[model samples]
Target: MTATLIFLLLFLLGLFLALRPLLGPKEPFPEPPRREELLEELEVLKREVEALEGEEKKLALARMVELERALEGYRPPEPRPFNPLPVALVLGAVVLLGVGLWRYTLPRLPGETTVTARAEARELKALSDKAKKTGAVEDLLAWGRKAFELGVYEQAAEAYMEVLKKDPRNVEAVRRVGILLFLSGRPEEARLFLEIAQHAEPMAAEGWLFLGNLYFQEGRYQEAIAAWERYLEMGGEARERVQGLIAMARAQAQGGKDGKSVYQARCAACHGARGEGGVGPRLQGNPILKAKEAVREIVLQGRGTMPAVPLAPEELSALLDYLDSL
Candidate 1:
């Protein structure tokens, strides 16, 4: 709206400026040079010539004759006629330009057609058509997972729903639907569905993660921590972030401890005092942090030659949070 108004104002200003010279005040033009003044000057030169004697007198008389002749012959230069063609052309161009600018700048009205932004939807539709043609569970699940990854919630939900319809016991489908429900703000239903999925697949890291998040949102800090712990134990890769989440939850559950202290005490020996790496892999800018759940699982179960170093839940939480910062 503001842009449109500004364009309109600019167009009006251009129009006014273009017309100002042509439509100026009607004051009479300045008087042309008077012939009488030239005549008087010539008469003065004639008197001076009479007073002079010698070559100066002859030059003066000659100049006086030239001036008299000029006065008699002089006529004002003719005014060039005003040509309206240039102004008309300029006005025509301005009008055309203003119309073009206005057309482009004006806001679109409601219900007006525009290029659609439904690439994901179109892709999902193709996947659905394929699933329908094949009538295969794997194909449906494939579409569901892809849709979820793309954040096409409706399509993901539809695919998952279809999976559930075919196999009610499909834990992955149930877990995903629960996640979608949680995202859609139906927490109570989400909890029921998530619990069912988690119960069916206790070692499913993703399910536990979602359940933990759900518990956290409900202020069930202890439950959230326990769920996240199970997720880590089950080899979830988002360990660093989940550990920080646990630390935050613990702070809400019981007064929090300094995460740095936990890191120095528990991790500094193996991971280095500054997390630059020692006996263990470098913690600074670690790729595992990017896959934090995987990192959490490694911490919980121990990886390669590293022994599982368990601490109090609070301390573990703090340590995870500290490591994530590194």
Candidate 2:
């Protein structure tokens, strides 16, 4: 409303300026020639009367009266000055139109639009910076979560990282960062942080499950199985499905020829070829039969201290086949 008033005032001012020249005083037109002609006739009659005798004087007087009556019947045109109001109004309207055009049309130009957009962007940036500096941890976290929800991974990661730094033991922050890292192709780093969080708070089933998935990604089938089993032991509820996975792995391990060979090439790298523990858990015994579901789940997922390995389905199948045979 205020903006509208200002625009109206400006338009009025422009109109007034345009019309001012027309408002000044104007000169009146000259009187008609009839008046001057009548005056000259009267002077001629006076001279004739002066020259006439008594009878001639009476006749002259009668002629003068007739002339006066004729003169009275002959009306002179009234003198008039030109009115400037109409011209002033036209000029004022033109000025108003020009001002209206300028105000409404100028901002639509590409350059002006670009400038306006840039200014808006700068203002937003300033507000964001201010919020980051002054807002509370919870507020920042909420904002970060909102960004994450919007699929702005980089912004979400930054927010989660800050939260982690501020409160290393924050389970939610740790989990969020881990997920972000995993999605960003940093599964190894994600696994590390997730494991730390799980160890810090073992009761968190989601953390354990996520850890198990990471171990599985790393090809530590036995470890993956172990983590999942632990999650279950801690009251995780996916028992039937987990058991089914365990049965499949055992059958494959028993049937495949490369079981021992694959184990030597891959499994030995961590757990040693002979089923003895090295960088990872021991593989010997019916640990598969004993901890079958647990082992499969752990290998399929991942656990603390292990990074996720990008294994193809066939490779995972073969590796599981080998672990089962062992």
Candidate 3:
């Protein structure tokens, strides 16, 4: 509601400025030259005309006639009638345009957030253009980072992929590309790149964090636990979060998985708590939930960013029951 008010205020202010010229005048009074002044000037001109001759006299006479005409014509001009029709039309157009833009072009976020996003978008374009022209790996990396942060995934992919084409061993590019692929719902490919990145730079803590999450999704509890440990050891941020994950992985490994618990521990972080969707698709209302066999197969074999989540038969049965509820 606050955001909507700010937008409305801004729209109204702009409309006011744009229509300022059309508002006409407030007084509606056109003050012509004073009648006494016109008569005085007319008398002075007549006296001058008598003293002049030929062209000079003719010029004076013309001035006197103009002055007399002004005096004659000087009944205060009538003000134009106030016409609301054109103004109403303009208002309607502005309203229609504002509604159209609100529906399509404007961001739904708060006003400040929307403005910041727009600014970042412009910067992203500038960085992209410069990087394209330079063809430098550093330039591309900068552009890729900006794009990724802005959630312009395709552009981010383009920038990172370009970096790979030029420098295949670039650790940052490799790790980030892997992360992008993961987010793009291609966990299999994401894992390959992430594995290469981890091996190439084991000290890269963030890579370990994601690699751990990937492993956890696959139900490789030990590997996930190990990767997360590595991440913690490397002093990756989110220490507490990773520790929680390690605890969960331990539970899963020990066969303590109830269906809802399994979903929370294995999938909630990515797919959203209520399965409304985040990094993965919304599980709620998904038709696949009705297909127990298909859901089981997908969980076991992995699909998209999900690696095979190998639950024990009992745990799997419980998970299927929980999924059916979703």
Which one is best on lDDT? 3
Error of 2 at 74 (Å): 52
How much is the lDDT of residue 223 in candidate 3?
88
Deviation in angstroms for 271 in model 2? 23
lDDT of 1 by residue, 95-143 (tens): 9768766455433433322223244445667888898788689999989
How do the residues 1-326 of candidate 3 rate in per-residue lDDT, one tens digit apiece?
56567667767865885587568567567567788899998888877777899999988888888888888888865776877776777677678768755654445322334556656767888999999999999999999999887778899999999999999999989999998988888899999999999998534898999899999888788789999999998988899999999999888865655677777777788778878899888989999788889988998999987778877888888778877787
Worst 10 residues of 2 by lDDT: 105-114
lDDT of each: 0.80, 0.66, 0.83
Q: Kindly give the stretch of ten consecutive residues in candidate 1 with the minimal lDDT sum.
A: 109-118
Residue 220 displacement in candidate 1 (angstroms): 1.4
What TM-score does candidate 3 reach? 0.50
Residue range with the least summed lDDT across 10 consecutive positions in model 3: 104-113
Q: In order, how many clashes per candidate?
A: 10, 26, 1
Model 3, residue 224: distance off in Å is: 0.4
Alpha-carbon shift of residue 201 in model 2 (angstroms)? 2.4
Rank the candidate models, highest lDDT first: 3, 1, 2
TM for every model, in the order presented, reads 0.42, 0.35, 0.50
